[model samples]
Target: MATKSDEDRASSYEPSSAGSDESHIPDVQNDCCNPLEETKYIVSESMLMELFNVCRRCQRLATPTVHQRVGTMVKIAAECEFCGFTWLWCSQPHVGSIPAGNIGLSASILFTGALPSKFLRVLRCIGVATLTQRTFSNHQASLLFPVVARVWDRQQRDYVTRAEDRGKPLVIGGDGRADSPGHCAKFGSYSTIDLEEGTVIDIQLVQVMISFQRTILCCTTMVL
Candidate 1:
């Protein structure tokens, strides 16, 4: 049912570096903050081994060994059997002990508002190995969440300062949504936005018990 153009477009969305040695094993250096360093590739293990078959230093036949494989990250070493030359390669750059690939994937899942379990399931179904849910949760809690909190705090402070400097009341709107329909809802989020600025100014999450009204009151109090 698909036309050639449709297939081409679909294939274009695939990772450009898939199964390619040049992109799979980058020369990861101290420059981990490079945006290009964050790009991830899905590589075929067999094809990658071919590049390691000959030592770069000696041009002799070499044996490739996988030193470690952590989810999408792999550490490989090649040793020349004839000339005794050796070198190492890594599938991704590192942030201290944590692989950049793992952090990048975790951050993407959270930033895109994707449900972690379902997103991870799709990745596994496609045979693209990735960090597990536990690791994702840990990354969110330890690394991503703190960064988000700090940035959000700074943004909110800036907004408040700007509003005070303008010497005019902010034109704002507020709305609340329940997690589930009707009285059975146990959780809800209420958000406020600056209508003039067209930006969300605050979001408050609350747990519902006796009534949704009570949760709305809590959200309002926190926002205030």
Candidate 2:
């Protein structure tokens, strides 16, 4: 015999149309971009909409204007002729953006991979047709910096606060290096180290010429 609780659950759990959709939900909640399937990816839709400027409600072409362009990544603004609804689109999706499109990574993964800067130019010049100068610059400023900052901040918080490291001596170390072979290069770097963990705590580029001691001092100041 069915229990009272079973009957209550049976009445409460009436299947709705959304229940069918539950099966269609992706295993991962946030899928960045699906390059294999164009219709399923939001970025592809946006790209197509930018190209066509279609009004979804009326099924007519809407007037599109250039809102912004980062590299070849042009963002278009458009409005529905009948409904007056407005929308925006980008020429290239974040996943479809350069480096990733050519090399296959979001901006976050590019710098972490530590692929040399020359590699990008080499790729573009040698007829790796997808890579471009603007894509490199755009990824550096827009995607790479912000992602790296967040990751660095998170690492500092997580590693420093670990129970093993706390109450022990703060064993810090650092090193500096020139961007190019020359000692008089415009770009150089200083990195703070967590000696206890054998990991780099932070890395910052020294934009101007400074004494060796001053550069070391900057790294020390950051970890402390």
Candidate 3:
């Protein structure tokens, strides 16, 4: 009878030992072999449309100007009603302008040449692309655009080559007067391929033109 009792205790103790080992094993595995988890975010079309609407409203309120300096060459100036937020638009089909009312979109648009690379790097570091669906407050949008644009233009050359290779054509089209000075310009255009693909992926060209205003400021400041 004592032998039986001893056997039971030994068997029970054996499981405890195995359980302890199993617990410790997972910790060890986590230290060396744990797999990475991918984080993801969903972006809905409605959200994109809302962003577009806000941009349009803001542009109307801002009242920008457009004019041609030479034959077929034009420039646009966009300014904000609530702030000193200003940007320039140009008639270059290979480069588009940034949008108003937020930083990420404006930066992404103005700094198009550097966007693909820097944006991907930022997304990876954050472990996700959750920014796609995020809506920016008017103030946040105004502040964020210029900062991102500065960073983007700083490394513009490095990324331009890749952007060109990707067959992304920069096109801007708008309905504002071609030879008048105004604050807000209503326009829209998309890449030739993206438009051909039947994708509703048109970007705002007036915004791009507005964002370009920064280039003029930089040049003026340099001359001063």
In model 1, how large is the Cα lDDT of residue 14?
A: 23
lDDT of 1: 0.70
Residue 62, model 2: Cα distance from true site in angstroms? 28
Tell me the tens digit of each residue's lDDT in model 1 across 148-197: 87667667767777777878766777777765655546677777787898
Candidate 1: regions farther than 4 A off:
1-29, 32-38, 207-224
lDDT of 3 by residue, 43-81 (tens): 333442233222233454454555332112234565666
Ranking 1 against 3 by TM-score, winner? 1
Highest TM-score among the candidates is held by which one?
1
Question: How high a TM-score does candidate 3 get?
Answer: 0.17
Candidates in order, TM-scores: namely 0.72, 0.41, 0.17
Error of 1 at 103 (Å): 0.6
By TM-score, is 2 or 3 better? Answer: 2
Provide the lowest-lDDT 10-residue window in model 2.
Answer: 19-28
